[model samples]
Target chain A: MNGDDRWDDDARAAYQLPIEGEEQARDRAILRLRRESAKRRTGMGAWWVDPDGLRMRPALAAVCVLAVLVIGAWSGAGWMASRGVRAPRPSIATLPSGSTAVTFVFRAPGATRVSLVGDFNGWDPEATPLARATTGEIWIAQVPLEHGLHAYAFVIDGRDWAPDPSAPLAPVATFGRRNSLLVVGEDQAL
Target chain B: MRRLLALALASSLLAPGRASGDESEEARLRARLKPELATPVIEVVRSAAAQGLPTAPLVARALEGASRQAGDEAILEAVRGYAAGLAAARRALGSTARAAELDAGAGALMAGVPEDSLASLKRARPSGSLVIPLVVLSDFVARGVPVANASNAVLAATRAGAADPALLRMRERIDERILRGEAPTGASREGLRELLMKTPGTPKERGSREPRERRQP
Candidate 1:
């Protein structure tokens, strides 16, 4: 209120700001840093680690890999087994001469009736009606013969001449057809 | 002891002949063998004949040498037995019913196997309507189908049309002719292949810049 020069230095110093506590300023600066860090941490949400979580993640991944490998191996093995294993194809059975039983098996699903036709009965289809076996699909017959190699075919449905499904096939003169060849060894029975 | 000494004396006397190799001895044995060997030879002949195979030459050769050889009765008899077995086999298989039955069954039996495998099988098991079944199977396998499918397809085709039976008959005839040493002509072969291929009706013409025969893709 006096506005005089007597306390000019004191007035100027009073008008100027005083230095604050260093500890307090440091505390304020630290508080601001912590707030910023909290905001950043909140932005990157918490990924808390459970007691067994670390072990479980790797264990699950390993189990998944193992399962895939096992499935793949099983599939591969099954495929190989299916491809490798096969049935025994039908073939001629030989027996000693004058011994009773000769059998033939031929597969012809489309044919209604199948008969054996060859030289023994002068190639008569009607004379040799082959019996069907337990499988019912195959045309089988047992007829006694003297002992020799014979040429033959399946007379299907009384009309069509078809070769045996299990016979040794030969390319014949007729397009799309084959003949069966059989050899009966003497004294070498089935 | 006396018999043993006699046998020694005989062997010593024959030692000079023993100096010869197997071929000479075989020949000498052939020359001195007897008729007792006929049984086996007949057996062999029967077996071969059963499949309508000609074992005559084999039997004749065996007998020719063995019968002349008064050397070993066993040799002659062995040869005859071989012939007999072959003959018996042939006779057994020669029956029309048996052969037909064998052939049809074989088509199915050889399914899913390769030709080489079947060939091995043939070697191992020398009986039945084998060669023909194997041939069909082999052809099918070569054409990319499993043996089962090939066999089934063939059976189906064989059952299919007006010409099916005729074709089957022709196959038998052709086989017989071949066995008798006749050479098959191209047209006949083509016809047969066509039948086997079962390409219903005439082969269709593929669109042609090149003729179908010349086209390779």
Candidate 2:
């Protein structure tokens, strides 16, 4: 038999045997109870009254709180970073000095009506429709330009965007189709 | 409801400003078309010829076309005036005419002098043929001349041809203002025409004055 097996058997036998010395057994039980009670009291004292124990406990608590705060801040920053960049708001465009007039010309063979919209005229689509020229092209009603650069575009037949062919081209497109930028000088170039 | 009310109020306020802008533009156009301001194409062409310049007949053709298109007598006259002046200046210098000379001629024509009179004045004094004198006159009239000229140097071009029929219309208007005794110093022939246009169908007494701008050399 293995040593552990023999030892287990012996323990079982010993447990099963009745105590021949009742006075000795009673003394051992009382001693065991007193030792257990002393240990519990010492544990409670360490929690409530021991200075070193209190200091160590508070330090551990602080470490845990700091870890939680760091995690929360990092998570919040990550969320903000993932949101991407916001677009710029459009400003009401004003003409610079010397600009007096602007002419818009659109070449759309299929279009029946063409209208211009921009920060000027409050983006009103129905305001002024372009008249058809002899070549089936569309031209604007004589628009008096303000001084400065203006961004505008043509809306053809209420659906499509058509840029002006005759006007100077603009590369910037922060809004819709590339806008027509017109620079009105201080003096009219008639 | 509140937003709609705010929008309505805002639009109502904006409407007056827009209307004012339109009225001003119309007024400016009306001023441009006054009958007394009109200068004939033939006088302009003949004036340039006198200056040893040649102008194509294309300008005349354009004037005639514009006249036909414009039923308003005043507008027709102004377009014809501009065309005539351009032709006369072009004839004087041909394609080789300097930009400064062209500008001066245009400014004078805009001021309402007959082209023939302008040519005769230029011939009367050798100084008038030069660009500097015409530029100065343009400046005195508050018009831009592409060339450089000191304030003292420019002189008026000549006027001698069939008396401008348009001048008679302008004369009545000028006499009205003169009777009322408005300051006559800065008044232009074109300005007088504009006044007459405003008082259309109102016959007034006629009077004449010496040409306000004469070459002094």
Candidate 3:
């Protein structure tokens, strides 16, 4: 009932980490470490690692399911990666200068990798990779652009510089391949 | 062995050029076409040649129609119209223009681009092949941009010395606008404003002011 010092410094320190509270805290800490170690040794998080829990038929079924899941995830990732990303702005926004955005699409169904390389991105294939659309054969990417003309081409499977079929030709044949033109923010009458 | 290998390589390289054989393109068109379509398609081809216009395009147009299994009457009309447009293009582009330019110009004409605008584009460049400009112009019209705006916008750029690359860039930007569901006219206007900023003396009217011709932005 002596409220002035609230329980004594020794009692307050008792609840603190144990260098101050010693034997009891030390014993509890050892018990927690042992429990964690035993749990990890049993691999309870992965039931298959515990042999008694595994039955022959269920084990085979689980393995098959795991394989299916992995293959499905891999294929699904390949499909999603192929679709790249298209910014869905249903309206043309008057964005600030240096804030224009455009999407590029290339329809190469069999290609494993597609990248956008252009003057804007220093013609680096690694700079902009396209992802495949899950439902379609097209590969696509949306890139922000500054207001000006930029020339580009799609590198299919890291080679085969293919110009966009819907884009205008840059007409300059760099390395015997024509580049495509992307005019970001301006319009020419024609 | 080396001589034999070199001769084989030479012949293989030459193979595609001779794929059509020694016959004229129209003759090939006739051979490949149905009986009803052959005569009129040939007439269009021959008439285009008589006018000093490229006949291959007309033949190709007919053959393309045939390949698509179009009706004979429709094929004939398309061939005739394509040939007439080629003639118009040749007239506007002058006798020195190339076959590719003529073909693309015809496409522009078919897409409702005015003949005089083609001529104006020719006058703007006045020296190089106009194939790309014509193609881009056709593309603009195909994308549903108003013909006059397309013509003027392209002409404005061409007048400012925009080449194939610049023209294509302009087109891609406008196309992005169209893809955003902007009306072709609105798309053209917004895109033109962007282009005008790059071109010197393009009357940029902010707020409610109307765009005055040839004024500095």
TM-score of chain A of 1: 0.43
Q: Pick the candidate with the highest DockQ.
A: 3
Candidate 2's C-alpha runs over 4 A off are A1-99, A187-190, B1-217
The true-versus-predicted C-alpha distance at residue A47 of model 3, in Å, is 34
Q: Between prediction 1 and prediction 3, which has the larger TM-score? A: 3
Expressed as tens digits, the lDDT of each residue in A1-190 for candidate 3 is 4765666765777777447568888899999999976776677455566655545688899999999999999897666445432322433344566556676767786889998877556456788998877745678787776554455678888766777666654422323455554444434211
Error of 1 at A80 (Å): 19
Grade the docking of candidate 2. Answer: incorrect
lDDT of each: 0.46, 0.44, 0.66
Give the residue spans of candidate 3 off by over 4 A. A1-190, B1-22, B199-217
Clashes of each: 117, 17, 14
Over B1-217, each residue of candidate 2 has an lDDT whose tens digit, in order, gives: 9999999999999989866754543343333334332234334444544554433221322222332234445334443554555666665434555544554465455544445544544554433232433432433333221111111112211222212223323333433443355543333443333433344352332113323343321
| A42-120: candidate 1 lDDT, tens digit per residue | 6433335333223357789899999999999978745533332111223334446543356666665556687877645
